[model samples]
Target: MDIKNKVALVTGGGTGIGRATSIALASRGAIVAVNYSRSKSEAEETVQWIRSEGGRAVAVQANVSLDREVRGMVATVVEQLGTVDLLVNNASITQHILLDDLEGATEEIWDELYGVNVKGMFFCARAVAPFMKSNKQGSIVNVGSIAGLTGAGSSLPYAVSKAAVHGLTKSLARALAPEISVSSVAPGAVATRWWEGREEQMNHLSPNLLLKRIAQPEDIAKMICAMLEQESMTGQILTVDSGQTL
Candidate 1:
């Protein structure tokens, strides 16, 4: 994966790690499609930044939870940028609910989280598979979370959804092997908008980690780029936590 002149699609590319990954890919000479569900302004801003930095990028709108939208998105990217050579399944959602509150983890919550966090990733991969297969080479990095491994996160359903994402990564790796490589980057607490009003909590947790600092979006973005470029690794889950899980 040279990344140079490749076409990269990053879902939820409007903010946080998605945004960072889009920029990183563009810097590496990949023409980037920044997919966003509702963050139109932010997505466009990211594209502008990339262009200003002398990189190529576009902002595509798609609600990744819908299979049709996912397919449509890939089609649009191909029409505009040729083919998708790399994909970052970074779109996800979470709800704030107590871990022990079974009632709080309602059917709606489960469905909502799984729809975007789990199934969305699968749909995107499936839609892009043919393009990658046609080229006989591609790479996918699903953005998972340490919560998936530990079953702890903003909400129970959120954690469960990420766990499913990790599983999906492995299965896709096997299914798309010999042509496409699939892997996952499970990040721990990072300084993103997800902690908008919980700065204090983030601060408290930072010192406890072995690194004694929360990871920035760029840190995870770097790991994601590394995963995309690693030719010998597939079906692997690389964690970018600043020793939070250690």
Candidate 2:
């Protein structure tokens, strides 16, 4: 689990938590495969920043929801970077709506969200599992959300998808144990673009938290690095929520 000179693949690496995680890994001397769906320019920017900081990184576009794309992503990472010793499954989507307005959540919306947040998570993990299996060593970190645990404020479907991510993380950990360490980071409200205009709601909930503030991407990113470099911990869901739910 010593990440020095290791290769790590981060889904949704174009922005937010993924972007932060990519930077973190690169800074630690890990070659990064920055995977993204859209956000092309931002992904490129992240890579540039990493390089500027004397880190090695490359942006790779891939829709984790698509099997072919996921396969191609893994292939490109291995071919170009040499190996995928770590994976951070941070790609996800959310459709915010009140449960009372559930009728408006059409089948298409449900499918699109589920495709990326849940099924896509599986695809990305599956794609990387073999590489780790062959090497007999790897770390897979699936990003989860507090919504999955409490289902308090987040959209229902988004919450459900994250719940599935948590389940997948545990299942994969148990299944891939002793060789590959699978774990999850279920963060609370972090100040990412996803919550751009929702500052009021975030702060309102923050005062109750032990930290009394929302998290920054770097906060979560640092914890991810800990999980990646520390192999002693496995099959655990590390919630970096500032104790809001406590």
Alpha-carbon local distance difference test for all models: 0.95, 0.89
Stretches of candidate 2 exceeding 4 Å from the true structure: none
Residue 106 miss distance in model 1 (angstroms): 1.0
Question: In candidate 2, how many Å is residue 190 off?
Answer: 0.2
For model 1 the TM-score comes to: 0.99
Candidate 1 — which residues are off by over 4 angstroms? none
lDDT against true structure, model 2: 0.89
Shift in Å, residue 5, candidate 1: 0.6
Candidate 2 C-alpha RMSD relative to the actual structure: 1.2
